[model samples]
Target: MSFITLFITASMPILKVLLISALGSFLALDSVDILGDIARKHLNKVVFFVFNPALVASNLAKTITYETFLTLWFMPVNVFITFLIGSILGWILTKITKPPKHLKGLVIGACSAGNIGKMPIIIVPAMCKEEGSPFGAVDVCQSYGLAYASLSMALGAILMWSYVYNIIRISSRDVVVEICASPSEGFDDTFKNSSKQPLLPSADYTSITTVNQSSFSSRMQQWLTTSIDKLNLKAILAPSTIGAIVGFVIGMISPFRKFLIGNSAPLHVVEDSAYLVGEAAIPTVTLILGANLLSGLKGSQIQYKIVIGIATIRYILLPLVGIFIVRGVVRAGLQLDPLLQFVLLLQYAVPPAMNIGTMTQLFGRGQSEYSVIMLWTYGLAAVALTLWSTMFLWLVAS
Candidate 1:
């Protein structure tokens, strides 16, 4: 297909995202007050706990088998590479732009993480449905597309909450201490309101009767327990993570696959029920994506140079490197699905992870700055995703 055809096919999905996002933004407006901060928070919880897990598990159960699962070993590596490269670039960006001390983590975190889960979940299947889509029959493409995307979502979540979460936490500690000591920094209202929340969830120290007088063994045990809690291990065991594990079990085990996956199976209703719930994940997420961006418009102290630097790293340079990494692997004799290749490349081009906002909230600073970055990068994402996605389709097809 010509570039125009591919561009049109790619842009269609992005356009849908933009439109729904616009509605989300509109509803979040003060006059509308429908998707305000509290509403978005509760809805986000629903998506995180309920809709997303169901989506991941149901799709994986339907399309994945042990053989196909084995072929996907490269994807997790691909996700890690994106993180590594983005981190390096982000570090370089911080040095060049020299943002405020508190903003360094926000900057680095934004550069390093991409919206690997939500964006792919929305874009991939939509691309498959397009009239000019290169992925072949619509139903087949959509099925396998969801499987690929669900796996990406699962892997991305594990990495983000563990790796990216730490990056923000470590960097934000200084700001947390500063706020605690002074309490007069004149941070934005959101930051001031959330300042009372602990930067890390505090461990109950009641068991330690006297910390200074504690025996070495007792102290060691206390330190170990606090270390585990501070690592935010609970996020690693999130609902989506559990869903992914369940999906893998269903997909890989012959008995589970036979029982739940096919129409002939006596228990296919279970899969159908999960699918019904999972289908809500995509639109709900896209709308929330828009609603979340409204905070960006409220204004903050972020430098435009930093925002531009992040955009360059995420949308331009990262995708270029991805082409080399993905194509190089394929050229060196590893076989991969064309659809998977497209997703790997698309992973590089997505905006920063939306969870960065949550991280900022957790650390009690940079919320305004993160909003500014999200506003610009996501605002730019429509054009960036369309063009890059078009190129990816053409490259894989050729």
Candidate 2:
């Protein structure tokens, strides 16, 4: 395809996201009152807990087999590298910009977690349907493309829930601690002074020292317990994670796979139902994403430098690094299909995951800042993705 043609083809899906998100933003307005804060919150809960898991489980169960899994083994590794490199870059950004403590994780997450799910799911198939796609026949390309997209969604969800989730969770907890500690500082000093008073005559210095040591040890243990509790492993192993696990089990285990997945299977109806529900996941998520972006328009105290730093890392640096990494892998003698290689390369160039907004809503911290970041990254994605897709297609096809 000509560069112009490729750019146009690539821009279409991104335009769709932009349009839908705009609708959501409009609906969220008080005058519209369609996707109000309460409605968006409830819809987000449904997406997070229900639609997303069903979508992941159904897609994974339908598409993944042990053979296909082995063939696509590099995908997970590629995704990990994206997260790893983006995270390192995010940390550097944090050190340089010094955003508020609560926003540090949001920044890191925005840097690290690409929009692996929806972008590919929408863009790749659309590209396949275009006139000059390099990925061969339309039906075959779409089939393979959707499979790749599905796997990306599943793995991305798992990582987003676990890695990104924890980073934001810990950062939010730190905010909580700071808020709580500020008011108690004077009380804490008074308590410390009283404790420093001379002990009763009956209590010898040796005995007092032993009591202090024991009390210190107990406090340490209690602190550890509190920290562990705050980790909230339940949030990490969210419904989406559980769904992915179930999908993998059904996908990889022959008997289970036979029982639930194929059309000929006795219980295929259940899988079909799940698939039907899963279809709603993308539109729902995009709508909520738009509504969240409205929050960004309300204005925030988030620094412009931090926003620019995130945009630069995600759009400029990550994509360049991805090209090098994918080429390096090929040079190292691990052959990949042209389409698969393109997908891997494109993975590095996507905007931040929409799930970050959902997570911020869940934690009730950094929502406005995250929304602003999302608005900027996604707004820029139309041009960035078009340009990158054109280059990637040229490179891969050549």
Candidate 3:
């Protein structure tokens, strides 16, 4: 089947669900019955701490051999280039399309090249080993792709910050001050507009008389007063950040290296817990994606052109970009195995992320729009991706 035909056929059933929900939303019927917030909320938490951290932890776990480090260095460079491409394309496309001024931010904000975290079903099938194999082996370096994705996360940060920078980049200051001043970008705190809070006396150890004391006490009080800011960057960065610290300590204790993953004690409990939470990542995201879809289906002033453009870029252009990148890498005589090629291209095609909707909701943009676009993006992505994978079977494993 052709890409469009395969996409539409594969997507029709899912399309029905979305259409009904969108119609219901358009009709102003209660959407929460069909759509629930539970999934979004749960996945938001998991992504923030467990899922994202595990991603970082797992990717960074192996010793950074010269070979791996070389790959790591190029990873950021690739993302910086990809970000430039994505941002410029999105900006120019938005300009020509001329969405509303308020929605200009939304349009650019809503679309992205891809997410750092892998969507295995979307990617793996396109890259899996062929049905019959001599050794029953498929080169699956999930970590390598994921590591590149982590850098994608940083590049994504820079891109989004560039957008937000439009709103706040007046006069810069010290790096530490800027980090402290950066607005909350993740869930729960995206809507924060104020920088001051009622000081919890416990979290802040200060006396009332200190307000009238010497300049030293006054400075201390000022520092304490001003320091309370968004806790999310710390929250999201903490798990992996802490994990790295722990991993380093483990590395230093070479004598005890065997004890941790060894046969004797087996840190199986901790291992199991991480696996369980990490496993929850995908389904939790899908469910939230489902609910977000239901809600969006309820209401939208969607431009069909934008939808098609996003779908085309994600399933078509994005992978093409990857192919170009891969060809260049190959032409340079770098040996990137087949699975890696598929994984890299697949990352470029993975659907618009659900976390974006969460952030949009927190920022008080239209929930209706957020939900609807997600419905359309994921729905079409299902088909667009399938066809792309099938058509390019030579690069694909399965």
In the range 324-372, model 2's lDDT, one tens digit per residue, is: 9998888898878888888999999999998888788888999888878
Give candidate 3 regions above 4 Å deviation: 1-35, 59-67, 118-122, 125-259, 262-269, 391-393, 396-398
The whole-model C-alpha lDDT of candidate 1 against the native structure comes to 0.91
- Model 3 CA lDDT for position 385: 64
Highest lDDT: give the candidate number.
1
TM-score top scorer:
1
Alpha carbon lDDT of each predicted model? 0.91, 0.85, 0.50
Model 2 CA deviation exceeding 4 Å by range? 173-230
Write the residue-wise lDDT of candidate 1 on 124-154 in tens digits.
9999999998788999999999988998888
Model 1 steric clash pairs: none
Regions of candidate 1 where Cα sits further than 4 Å from its true position? 175-216
Clashing pairs in 2: none
If ranked by lDDT, best first, what sequence of candidates would result? 1, 2, 3
- lDDT: the better of candidates 2 and 3: 2
How many clashing pairs per prediction, in order? Answer: 0, 0, 5
- Tens-digit lDDT track of model 3 for 224-326: 7654332234433445455444443433354434444233535535533543455444444444445556565566886767766666666676678877886
What TM-score quantifies how close candidate 2 is to the native fold? Answer: 0.82
